[model samples]
Target: MEIKIDDLQGSGIIRLLEEHLADMHATSPAESVHALDVKALQHPSITFWSAAEGNSVLGCVALKSLSCDHGEIKSMRTSGAARNRGVATKLLNHLIADAKSRGFKQLSLETGTQAFFSAAHGLYAKHGFVDCEPFGDYQPDPNSKFMTLVLEQ
Candidate 1:
């Protein structure tokens, strides 16, 4: 599989992001949903990437700059057919390496607290992320769980 930086304009990538946002809303309350739409993902502060095998998109992930030393992981999604195939793991490792190269000291993310997100929690935990207090503009929300990974230089 190949992973490449994306501009959020391709139809396949957009469709996957739409599905991701929809799943977030379906699993979390409207007040707790933080997934960004296509336009939001295209912000200058964010870098989006897609993982594909030739012409088939397997997954996608994004990194959003929060500060000079901190960044946030956003919009991580793997196609249903691609789950359990290490797609997320590969993309996450890529983002972590990229983050370090870009001088980010930490990477954080917000996900749902419900059972629907348990798999995600495990995935992050497996990658060395630990539970943390809300960062950035986030506040304490029962439906939201925050995780952070402190990157080493």
Candidate 2:
């Protein structure tokens, strides 16, 4: 799989993002929904990437700078057809490596508390992320679960 910085204007990537956002909103509560739309993902503080095989988009992830030493994971999603093939894992690993390269000391994320998010939560845990309180603009919401990983570098 090739992971490349994404141009939000691309129709394929845009469609994947739109589908991800819609799935999140449909399964998660209003306050627990944190997936960003194309406009928001294009913010200067966020770096977005897409995992693709030729012309097909397999998955995507984004890193949003929260501070000089901190970053938040955002908009992580793997295409339905690409599930169980380690696509999300690769995208996440790429984001984590990018954060470390940028001198970030911590990486955080927010996911749902429902069973729908179990695989995601497990994936994060496998990468050393531990449950934590809400960070940044987030407030405690019963429907959400927060996790963070402290970078060794």
lDDT of 2 by residue, 77-99 (tens): 99998999999899998999999
How many pairs in model 2 have backbone atoms within 3 A of each other, for residues 3 or more apart or on separate chains, i.e. clashes? 0
Error of 1 at 92 (Å): 0.2
- Residue 145 error, candidate 2, Å: 0.5
Per-residue lDDT tens digits for candidate 1, residues 22-141, read: 898888889999999999988999999999997788999999999999999999999998999999999999999999999999999999999999989999999999999999999999
Off by over 4 Å in 2: none
Model 1 ranges with Cα > 4 A deviation: none
lDDT of 2 at 35: 88
| Model 1 / residue 123 / CA error / Å | 0.9
Best by lDDT: 1
The Cα error of candidate 1 at residue 19, in Å, is: 0.7
Q: Local error of candidate 2 at 112, Å? A: 0.6
Model 1: how far residue 30 lies from native, Å: 0.6
For the record, the alpha-carbon RMSD of candidate 1 to the native fold, in angstroms, is 0.7
Q: Model 1, residue 153: what's the lDDT?
A: 99
